[model samples]
Target: MPLLAGFATSLSLIIAIGAQNAFVLRQGLRREHVLPVVLTCAVSDAVLISGGIAGLGALLTSSPLALSIAKYGGAAFLFTYAVIAARRAVRPGAMSPADHAPAALRSVVLTCLGFTYLNPHVYLDTVVLLGALANQRGTDGRWIYGLGAVAASFAWFFALGFLARKLGPLFARPRAWQFLDAGIALVMTTLAAWMVLPAH
Candidate 1:
């Protein structure tokens, strides 16, 4: 029962669309850098999820001032990303006239890096909060909880990236790109606000 509960909770936490998922979907729809982006996201999540399960989150949470800094930092990053996404929507980017697409491998690598490192939200939610949540289950259930979280990350990333690629052609329309970019901006702005909320 505890394992099941933990799994459910973890799934719920991960299911929400967020910065990482946003980047993956965007890249996938562009069909610019599929494998590298997918792989980087998966690998980064694996490492952070592992660290959270290992209880390193304790140190992060131990300092109230540090936590505040992290939250504010995350908020700033999200807001900045929101602006960039909006700009892209208003002015969509294109690959070089000669090149078919932005170097797929490099693009994916960089996007993944941004999702994992630059986006402060990733660290706060995945590392600190998830770690704290895992610890609540006690030593016996901790591993199971961590497993569930890991599963959620893997399942979501693979499924979203796969589906997004399939839908890439549909997004080829100019209006579709606008809609996606707008959606990205909206999500980022909302998340940024949420992060800075009083109770947050």
Candidate 2:
């Protein structure tokens, strides 16, 4: 029951509309750097979750300077990504299958690394905070809790990617591509703005 509770907690922490999930779903639909992208998302999540259970993630939230740096860096990256997406949206049919280059697999790896590791919220919610809370059940329960957390990472990646792949057919039209690009831009920009906003 405790382990089950831990697992539920893990799912609640991760199953949300965040940068990592957004990137994964988008790439899955676009059939972009999928293997690498999913791997990056899953692996980074695992490492952070493991560290959270180990109680290392809490340290990040305690350091205001480090937290600020991560927030700004994430915001900058999101804004730049948003601009690229907006360009794709405005330039309809500028790319065709022949013109398309392979998706940035290596870059996705790095981007996911940053998105998972450099987000103060990740550390606060997953590692330092979640880990500490999961352990409250007892040493044995902590192990179950950890497993649950890891399971959440795996389930989310596969499920999200699966849904994206299913949507590929529906988005084959040029106009559909534009719509997707524009949506990506809006989501990224909005999230970036939220990150950059000063706390009230």
- Using TM-score as the measure, which candidate wins? 2
| Highest-lDDT candidate | 2
lDDT of 1 by residue, 1-200 (tens): 55565556656766678887888887777666666777787678668866887877777677888768767887887888899879867865432112244655765686578666766567766787777788788888877777777777777777778788787567767677777888999999998898888872
lDDT of 2 by residue, 51-123 (tens): 7777676676678898888889888888888898899889879433334776676776787777676566677
Candidate 1: worst 10 consecutive residues by lDDT? 92-101
TM-score of each: 0.79, 0.89
TM-score of 1: 0.79
Error of 1 at 98 (Å): 11
